[model samples]
Target: MQNTRIILIGAGIGGLTAGLALQRRGFKVSVYEQAAQLGEVGAGLTLSPNATHALEAIGLGPDLAKLASRPARQAVLHYRTGDVLVDQERGDLPKKQYGADYYQIHRADLHDMLARAVQANDPTAIHLGHTFLGLTQNSDTVDVVFKNGARVTGDVVIGCDGIKSEVRAQLWGRVPPRFTGNIAWRGLVPMYRLPPGFKIEPASAAAVGHKHSMARYLIRNGTMLNYVAFAEKSGWETESWSVRSEVSELLEEFDDWHPSFKTFLAATPKDLCFKWAIHDRDPLPQWTKGRVSLLGDAAHPMLPFLGMGAATGIEDAVVLARAFQQAKSVAEALLRYENARRERTTFIQMASRAAQERLQGGKADGYTKKEHKNEEFLGLFSYNPATVAV
Candidate 1:
C-alpha cells in the first residue's frame, strides 16, 4: 500500500470509491472511464446501512447527508388494496442496529460527489474517453492498451467496467449476462407535479401484485419522486440502457394497481419514460487472475431485489483496499480480497434470485416468520466492510 500505482478500469461508483480509498491509503491512483463525459443513467439508489458505513469510513459521511434522502421508514404494501405488509423504521433503527444510516439518493448525485472528491485529492487522477482494449503484463507491471492506441502501465489493474466488461471478457471468455424475463420501467417526477391529496410516504416503499412489483421513493431531499415498476415480459431483444418506451405502455402495465400509484404514473412525461431488461450473471469461481481482479457488476451481477447491487460493489472497494494495506504484495492483497468477498457476494446473489422468484408468485416457504420475512436484507445491512476481516 506504499505508493504503488493503481489503475482502475471504470469510473463508476465502485471505481471512484476504490480510487479515493486507495489514494487515502497513500497509493498513487489513476481511473479510466470509457465515456467522454461521466454520468449515471438511473433514477435512484438505495444505500443501506452497510454501504453508508463504508462511505463514512472513506470520509464521505457529511457530504452524503447534504446530497441524499434519509427516509424515516420503509414499507411493503399490497399492490391492489394499499395495505401495509411490512413497515420498518429506518431513522434510528439502522444506527442502533447496524451503526450507520440508510439513504436514498439520485444516482447522478452520488456519482458527481465521488468524482469531485477524487478530483479534490488529485486533479489528474481520472481520465475520460479512455476505452480499455486489452492488457499485457510481465512480472512487475501491467501494460494497458486503449482504443485510441495509447498504452499505460501500472503496478495493478482493477476491473470495475460493468456486466459487459471488456476486462472480464479478455481475462475469462465472452460470457453473456443472462436475462431473467423481467422488464422494468423507471422515471422521476418532481414533487410539484403531483396532484393534491396524492400522498406519497416519506419512506422507501414497494407494492407487490401478481407477477409485478412497484417501488416508489424520494431522492434529492424529497424534491423528486423516483419510481420503478417491474413486470414479466418476453421478446425484449435490446440490451442497452437507452431504450425508450411509451408512457401509455407504462400506464397499461400498472392500470390495475392502487389509484394513488396510478395518479403518480399519469404525471410522468412520455419522453422521460425509460425501460431496461434485468440481466445478471452467475458468480464467478474466481475474481482475481494474477494482478487483475473484477469488481462490482463485473464480478457478481445480481438481481436488484435486495437493492445491494451497488452497495456490494462499494463493499468490494473498501475490502480490496484494506487487503492491500494488510498484505505484503499486490497479488497477495488481491487473493485476500477475493477470499473475503466471494462467499458474501455469492450468497447475496443467490438470495436475490430467490427473492425475485417469490415476488413473481413462486413458492412462499421462508417468507412467513417475522425475522425471516426480510432476512435477505439483514445480512447485507448489518455488514461493516471496513472492519470485516480480509
Candidate 2:
C-alpha cells in the first residue's frame, strides 16, 4: 500500500467526510468537488443518533452541538386542524433507549463544520471547482477523469459524488435517477417573525410536521426555522438546482393551512425557497468495480424522509475508513466496505421512499403517533461507530 491514495469525487458531506476519515486511517486522500466553493444550499438536516455516532468518530459530535439542537421532546404529529395526534417525549427515550441523541441542524452549518475539519485535518485535500467526468481502473490503480480534462491517479477512486455521478455512469452505465413523483420546496425564516404560540408544532417553527411527509426544523440555534414543502407530483417544467425558487409557488401549497405556516412562508424572500426534485436510484448490484467504488448518493441517493441522508453518508465515510483500517489490501478493503454498506444503505433508501409515501398521505398507513412506533427509527439512530465499526 505504498503511496496509497484515495481520490474522492464530490466534496459533499460524504466526500469531505471521507477525506477526513481516510486521512486519519493513514491514507493520502484528495476530494474533488464541482462547486467553486465548499458548501451546501439552504435547508435543515437531521442527524439521528447513529449518524451522530459516525460524526463522533470523526470528532465532530460535541462541536456540532453548538450550532444544532437536541429537541427536549420528540416529534408531535397533528392533523391539518391542529388536533394533537401524539405527544411522545423524545429526550430520554431516543438517547437512553437508542444510544445517541436525535439532532437537527442547518445543512450549511454542518457542511461548514465538515469543510473546516477537512481543511484543518488535511489541508489542500479538498479541491473545489473540479468536476468528475469518468474513471478508469486497473487491478492496482484507478485514474479519475475530471471535467477539466485532468486525470489523477490513485490507489482507488470513490464516487462520493452525488445523485448525478459521472463515475457511477461509467461503471454501471447511465441509470438516470428516477423521480419519486414528489417535489420538495425548502425555505428559511427568522425565528422572531414567527407567532409566539408557534412554539412546538409541526408546520410551525414549533414543529417539523410530517403530514405532507415533508421535513422542517429549526436551525442556526433556533434563531431560524428551515421549511421543507413537498407534494406528490412533478408539474415543474424542469429540474435543476440553479433555477430560481419562487415564493408564491411555495405560498400556494400551504394556502389553506394554519396561519403559523402562512406567516413563515410570507416571511421568506421571494427567491429564498428552492425547488428540489426528490430523486433516487435503484440499489446497484455492486458498488466496487476493480479499484473504484461508489459512496453516498452516488451509490445510494435518497429522499429526505426519515432524515438519514447526511447521516448515512457520514457513516459511509467512517465505514470506508475502518474497512481500510482492517483489510489486508486496498481492493479487498473496497469489497469489504461495499459488503458492509450495500445492504444497510439499500434498506435506508427504500425506507426513505416508504416514509415519503406516509408523509404524502396519498396512502395512509397509521395516523396515531403511538402506532407509528418507529422500531427502525431507534435502530437507525443507535449506531456507535467507534466500537461498532472497529
Candidate 3:
C-alpha cells in the first residue's frame, strides 16, 4: 500500500484533506484541480467536533486553533422581534462532550492550511490547471485524462470533484443536481463597520422567519462577521459562488427583518455580497466501482442547513486514509471506505433537508429547542471519524 499511487480529482477541501492524509500515511498522492489558481471562496464554515477530531488526527490541531474562532454561544432568534428563541453554549461545551473543540473559520484559511501541509509533504503533490475530462479503469489501475492533454495512471482514483463532477458523470451519466428552491445571499462585514452599541452576543445566531432565514457568525479572529440569508424563490438557478448582487437588493429583501439584521446588511461591503442557488443530490446507491470511487460532494452533496457539508467531507478524507492503511489491496480499500461512509453521509444528506424545512417551513415564533434537529441534537458531533470503525 505504501507504493500505491493515488489520484484525486479536484483540489477542494476534501481533496486537499485526502491528499494530506494519504501523504502522512506514506502513500504517493497527486491532486488535479480545474482552476488556474488555488483558492477557496470568501466564506465561513463551521467545524463541528467530528471535523476537528479528524483534522487533529492528521496533526492540524494547533494550526486550526490559530486560524479558527471558537464561538462561546449560539442562538436561534425571531426574525421580526429579534427575541432569542433558543440559546445554547458552544465554547467549552463541545470540548467537554465530544473530546474536540468546535470552530468557525474562513474557508480560504482552512483550504490554505491543508494545501500548505500537503505540499510540505511533497512539493509536487498538487497539479493545478488540469481540468479532469474522464477516466478509464481496469482491474489493476485507473488512467485519468485531463483537458490539457495530460494523462496519468494510478492505483486508485478518488473523485473529490464537486456537484457537477465530470468523474461522476463518466461513471454514471450526467444527473443534474436538484435545486432546493432556495436562493442564498452571503456577505461579510468588518467588525468595526457596525453601528455603535451593536452587540454580537451568542457569537453565532440564526434569525428564522416565514420562508426566510439568516445565519450570522464571527470568523477570522472575530474581525469579520459572515452572514448568509436564505429565501425560497424560483426562476433563478445560477449556483456559482462568485455571482455578485447589489446590497440594495439585499436590504430590500429583508427590509422587515429585525433591526440588527438590517444593520448588518447595511454595513456589508457592496462587492462582498454574492448570491447563489442551493442545490443538493440524492445519495448514491454505491460510491466505489472497482478501483475508482467517489468522495465528499461527488458521493453525497448536502444542504447547508446542518453546517455539516465540509465536516462530512473532511471525515470522508480521514476514513479513506484509514481504510487504505488497513486493507491489503486497492479494491478492498475502496470498498471499505464506501461501506463505512454510506450510512453516515446518507443520513446527513436527508437530515439537512429536514433541517431546512424546519428552519424555513414554519413561523420563527414557533421554534423550540425540544423540536430542533441540528448537528448537536442529532448526535453528529459525537462521531469521532479518527477513531470510528473504518
Q: For every model shown, what is its TM-score relative to the native structure?
A: 0.96, 0.92, 0.99
Give the alpha carbon lDDT tens digit for every residue of 1-390 in model 3.
Answer: 889999999999999999998887888899999999999999899999999999999999999999999999999999998999999998899999999999999999999999999999999999999999989888898999999999999999999999888888888779999988999999989999999889887889888887889889999988999999999888999988999999998889888898979998999987899999999888988888888898889989998999899899999999999999999999889888988999999999999999887888766877888767778989999999889997
lDDT of 1 by residue, 1-390 (tens): 587788999999999989888877767799999999989986899898889988998999998889988888888777777777677788878888889988999999989989998999999999999999999887799999999787999989999999899999888889889888989888988878889767787468877677788778989878789998988898984566688888889889888888878888888877788899999898898888878989998889888877888999999999988998898899899999999999999998988887765565622222333523443355678799989989
* Per-residue accuracy of model 2 over 1-390 as CA lDDT, tens digit each: 535787888888888888888877787788898989777887787787778777877888778767777666554334254445545565556678766667788888888888888888778888878888777677777877778887889888888888888888988899778877777777888878666766635322222243454445667767877877776665653455555677887777766565656777777766677787777788888888888888888888877766677788888899989988888888778877888888888888888777654555532324665445342443676666555643
lDDT of each: 0.85, 0.73, 0.91
Q: Residue 259 CA error for candidate 1 (Å)?
A: 1.1
Any residue pairs clashing in model 2, and if so which? 50-381, 74-90, 199-206, 201-206, 201-207, 212-359, 213-359
Residue 292 error, candidate 1, Å = 0.5
Stretches of model 3 off by over 4 angstroms after superposition? none
Candidate 1: give the clashing pairs.
none
Range of the 10 consecutive residues with the lowest summed lDDT in candidate 2: 202-211
Ranking by lDDT: 3, 1, 2
- CA RMSD of all predictions: 1.9, 2.6, 0.8
